[model samples]
Target: MISAHLPALQVVIPLLAAPACVVVRQSTLTWLLALLVSWISFAIALTLLVQTFFNGPMSYELGGWAAPLGIEYAVDVVNAFVLVIVSGVSSVVLISAKESIERETHIKRTHLVYTGWLLCLTGLLGITITGDVFNVFVFLEIASLSSYLLVSLGPDRRALTAAFQYLVMGTIGATFILIGVGLLYMMTGTLNMADLAQRIPGVAQTTTVRAGFAFLVLGISLKAAVFPLHYWLPNAYTFAPSAVTAFMAGSATKVSIYLLLRFFFDIFSETFSLRTMRLDLILLILGVIAIFSMSLVAIYQSNVKRMLAYSSVAQVGYMVIGISLATTTGLTAGIVHLFNHALMKCALFLALGCIVFRLNSVDLKDLAGVGRRMPWTMAAFVIGGLSLIGVPATVGFISKWYLVLAALERDWWWLAFMVVASSLLAVIYIWRVVETAYFKTGPVANTEEAPLILLVPTWVLIVANIYFGVSAVDTISFATRAADQLLSTF
Candidate 1:
């Protein structure tokens, strides 16, 4: 019977725990509560994903209300996969958060930090699980607001500026999504995504509907940090507390990409989004631009975190490229990369968190001799970096191989070439850190490795990167099934 309420409990547990964190107002206790909530959420998500895999889509109505009149939580292969990613990342990140949070923020503000973390997690899970478009907007705000709070808690004074910038841009994005949702409601008279999907084709030709589509896509693009709209990301990641960066890097944009897939492939027909709206070409052009430009930008960043931040934008481009191809193989590549990139980026950031834990800085200059000084931490960084470069036997390679296969399937040799070229650019940025940490020699402040607490979780993701890469059959299968389900709307 309790299993029947898994859908509600998935979000409710964290949502309720967030306030309890503030009420407890004790750092250690708040962290324990968050950790427990995150692990439970992960368990629920994994269960839901497994159930959806075997049973197909599952839907739950809130308060026994049914159909288009009430809020619904829907699970399919696509969102269930995302739920696992978000909650799983939160669980790992929180395991290491206690050490990182205390070092980077005021000790007294620790409860607030944990509260924000839970709220952010709750928001991302809510967005993924909810079937109502309105609820998506609401959850997006919760995540955005909490992210701003977490970012502002960074030790640097510039963190306030970063948080304010994020707040402004995030607010603008939320407004766009709200307006788009209102337009859809006006046309369909329903907020439920399943109901709207059934009605959208009737008004798909209207100017209002077209405008709404544009607004919605634009809004999500901003949130996902798609190149031109990504001005806030580098600074936010550069200055935010380490654990916050790690969690958000892994989850937030991935959820935005999930929304894009949901809207394009589920709510709007593939024919409409790809053919009528020409979204495929639009995303292709932007994706190509983002990959080349952002990777080049990343190579120049002095801050290691900022470098990875720009790389994150480039990685988004790869996902966009896969989505733009609008074929099953293409969507599979995009979806798989969504999962793969999360693993690598989170690992990379966590490794950096370890360096930050000891050195109090992520500047390249500060990282000199870190490879020798903190061998385990830098080792984790190296593996994560190699994954970022898409080297064979790493998860990044798995993602790119699928993407290249998708490109070749379309006879898009040029696109495939660009993918390889962009990956090489990643090598340059990643190698910059490697060269600095390993090759460059200098007096360093810390010679000891990060504590086992941080190193364990960092390597957990690092090992996952290699494990999933070598044994990619299951991941590929899951992504393929998710892609097929999405393209079924065509």
Candidate 2:
């Protein structure tokens, strides 16, 4: 009975906690409630991942309704891995949020901040676990709306502007997704993803189906911050509170990427014409461009947070490259990097959060000599940076090794070379921060480090980067299963 309810409880726990936080109206109590909810969700995700692995995919129909008639929460290898990533990152970020929230948001609105945080968490989990196509759009908007509120709560005046821009873009993305879902419903007369997968093959030749696929891919790509459409991400991440940035940056776009994988490999694979649409080629070209161009942009950023934001886009390119390869190996690489990148980015951003907490700045110049003052925090940054560069014996290296192997499997040596060269760009940008932090000297003498409360979570992720890298069998196994599940749908 408990196993059967895991799907519903995964989203419901956080969904209910959002309203509870508002009604309680006590800032510290609300934060504690949110943290408890996030950790519970994380545990539930682990159980679901293990359950799916041993028992095959599990589907829980809402209200005892079955098939095309009612909504379902399906947990397969594909989304089970993503559920772990989203809930796991949320737990880590919430653990560090209390101090960051007090510093960035007004005490009067702290309860409101917790409300939005839990709502955002609920929406993200709902998107990952839901089996209805229309429900995906509904949850997407929920997350997007709360995301705007979170960004707007940042200390800077530009937070308002950033939030507004994200709102406009997020609305457009959500609308396009709804339109695509509507078109599919028109053709199939079903809202459930499984039913649509079965119905789509019959309508594969219809222009409406092709158009819907096009719209969905473009819309999801925008949300995933896949190059050209990524204009909203840098500003939003840079201006949002550090904890908010860590949570969203680590999990949000990855959910979009999961949506893309679900629709294309699961739904469109039934149609078998996505390849004829030349999507693979398009993604490969765009992915290569994104990898190089965004890394270049990151190299020039004066603000450290914005720099990492651009790096996020570049990292997304690596995922796209894996998807574009259209092989099981390629998909496995993408899925593996999806989880690994979340770890590295969270560690890096949380380390920056520690810097911001102590120094009150994330400017490259302000970080000068920080390594001496905050050795543990800066050391975490260095270790995270090494992982970002795909250095040997770090989680990043494992992802890149798989990516290169996938490229070679496709006989695309050039793409393999691109992966290595782009990693070199990460080296340069990370070195820029290292030079400023350890080598360069600040005028003021400072000797304060972040409190243990923040340092513990930050270092935990850093250690994971190494621990998982050295013993990557478990992560690789899960990713391989997810890839196989997606590919088997073909």
Identify the leading candidate in terms of lDDT.
1
Query: How do the residues 212-270 of candidate 1 rate in per-residue lDDT, one tens digit apiece?
Result: 99999889988999878888888898889999999999999999999999999999999
Poorest 10 consecutive residues by lDDT, candidate 1: 439-448
Which regions of candidate 1 fall more than 4 Å away from where they truly are? none
Q: What is the alpha-carbon lDDT for the whole of candidate 2?
A: 0.91
TM-score computed on alpha carbons, candidate 1: 0.99
User: Model-by-model lDDT, in order?
Assistant: 0.94, 0.91
Displacement of residue 216 (Cα, Å) in model 2 is 0.6
